[model samples]
Target: MLVDIRVQEEGFSLDAELARLAGVGLDVGGIGLFMGLVRGDGGLAALVLEHYPGMTESMIARIVAQAGTRFGLLACTVIHRVGRLPVGAPIVLVLCAAAHRGAALEATEFVIDWLKTQAPFWKREEFPDGQGRWVAARESDEAAAARWGMDGPTES
Candidate 1:
C-alpha cells in the first residue's frame, strides 16, 4: 500500500495530487476524495489553524494506518493545511484508492471522520468585526466519528 501524508501552510493543487496517485499503478479501480473548505458564514474573515509539529503528524499517521489496515486500501493520501486561511480556501483533503469502490469509499470516510476528532489541531475563526474566537468541537462531528465504532477518536 502507498501512504502519503503531509501537513503544510501552502495551498495544494488537487490535480497534482491526483496525478501522483495515478502513478501508483493499475490495480487501483476506485478513488475516493474529500475536500474541506473554510466557510464564509457569520461574517467570517479567516480561519486560523494551529498544531503541534511532530505530534500532529504522528497522530494522523496512526489514523491513516488504521484506515489502511481496516479497509485494505491500495493507496491513500492525506493533506491538511495550517496557518491563517481566507474564507472558501481548502483546509483538508483525503484521497483513498482501492481495488473496489467500497473499500476506497469506506476508508476515505473513516480517515476523515477520525481526523476531525483525533487530529491535534486548534482552530480559531476571525470575524470582520475585529473579533476572533476559538472554534469548539460540535456534537454533530463527535457523533459522526462515533459511527465507525473504532478504538480511535469518538464521542465520549
Candidate 2:
C-alpha cells in the first residue's frame, strides 16, 4: 500500500484506522500507535511550518513507502498538522498494525522517528519572550533518520 499523507490545520483521528486494520490480513495480532501534540513550551509556537505542497507530500510518501518495505507491517498511517495551532493540540499521528506486537510497535516508532528528522516541513517556534525563532535543524533528527536503516529521505 502507498503511504498515507495529510498536511492540514485540523486534528487527525486515529480510531478509524484502528478499526480497519484490526484482525485484517495476516491476522494482525496487535497494533501500536503514537500521537504527538503541541507542547506548552514556546519552542514550537515561535515558528510556523511552511511547506512546498506537492513536494512535501511526495517526500513524505517516499519515506513512508520505504518504511513499509523495510518493516513487516500490515498497515501504517501518518498524519501531520500545519498552521497556527494552539498548545496541547494534536500535531502528528502514527499507527501501525502487524502480525506481532513487536513488529507493530517498531514500525510505529520508525514512522514517527523518521518523520521528525526527515520530513521537509520547516518549523519556526514562537517564544513567550517575544523572540520567535526557527528551529535549527536537529542533528538528532538526522541521526534519527539514519538509524531507520534507510540511506535517508529520498531526494526530490
Candidate 3:
C-alpha cells in the first residue's frame, strides 16, 4: 500500500492528487476524497493553524496507518495546511483508494473523522476588526469522532 502524508503551508491541486492515486495502478477499484474549507462564519476573515512540526506528522501517519489496515486501503494521502488562510480557502484534503467503493469511502470518512479531532493542530479565527481568538472544539465534532469509539486524540 502507498501512504502519502504531508503537512505544509501551501495549497494543493485536487486534479494532481487524484492522478497520483490513480497512479497506484490497475488494482485500485475506487477512490474517496474529502476537502475541507475555511468557513466565513461570524464575520471571520481568516483562520490561522499551527502544529508541532515532526510530532504532528507522526500522529497523522499513525492515523493513516490505522485507517489503511482497517479498510484495506491500497493508497492514501493526507494534506493539511497551516498558517493564515482566508475564508473559503482549502484547509485539508484526504484521499483513500481501495479495492471497492465501500472501503474507499469508509476509509476516507474514517481518516477525516479522526483527523478533525485527533490531529495535533491549533487554530485561531481572525475577524475583520483586527481581532483573533482561539477556536474551541465543538461537541458535535467530538460526537462525530466518538462514533469510532475513541475517547481522546492519543487513542487514535
Cα lDDT computed for each candidate against the true fold: 0.90, 0.72, 0.91
Candidate 2: stretches off by over 4 Å: 23-26, 42-47, 128-131, 153-156
Q: Score candidate 1 by lDDT.
A: 0.90
**Per-residue C-alpha lDDT of model 2 across residues 1-156, encoded as one tens digit per residue:** 434578887776567766766736767788788988767763544346676788767777777777677677767777888876666777788877777888878878887877776677877777666667676887887787677666675754
Q: TM-score for all predictions?
A: 0.95, 0.83, 0.95
Give the C-alpha miss distance for residue 45 in model 2, angstroms: 5.2
* Candidate 3, 14-71: lDDT as tens digits: 9999999998989999999999999998999999999989988888898898888888
Candidate 3: give its CA RMSD in angstroms: 1.5
- lDDT at 86 for candidate 1? 95
Residue-pair clashes per prediction, in order, are 0, 6, 0
Per-residue accuracy of model 1 over 14-125 as CA lDDT, tens digit each = 9998888877889888889999999999889999999989978888888888888889888899999999999999999999988889999999999999898888898999
lDDT of 2: 0.72
Consecutive 10-residue window with the lowest summed lDDT within model 3: 147-156
TM-score of 3: 0.95
RMSD of each: 2.1, 2.5, 1.5
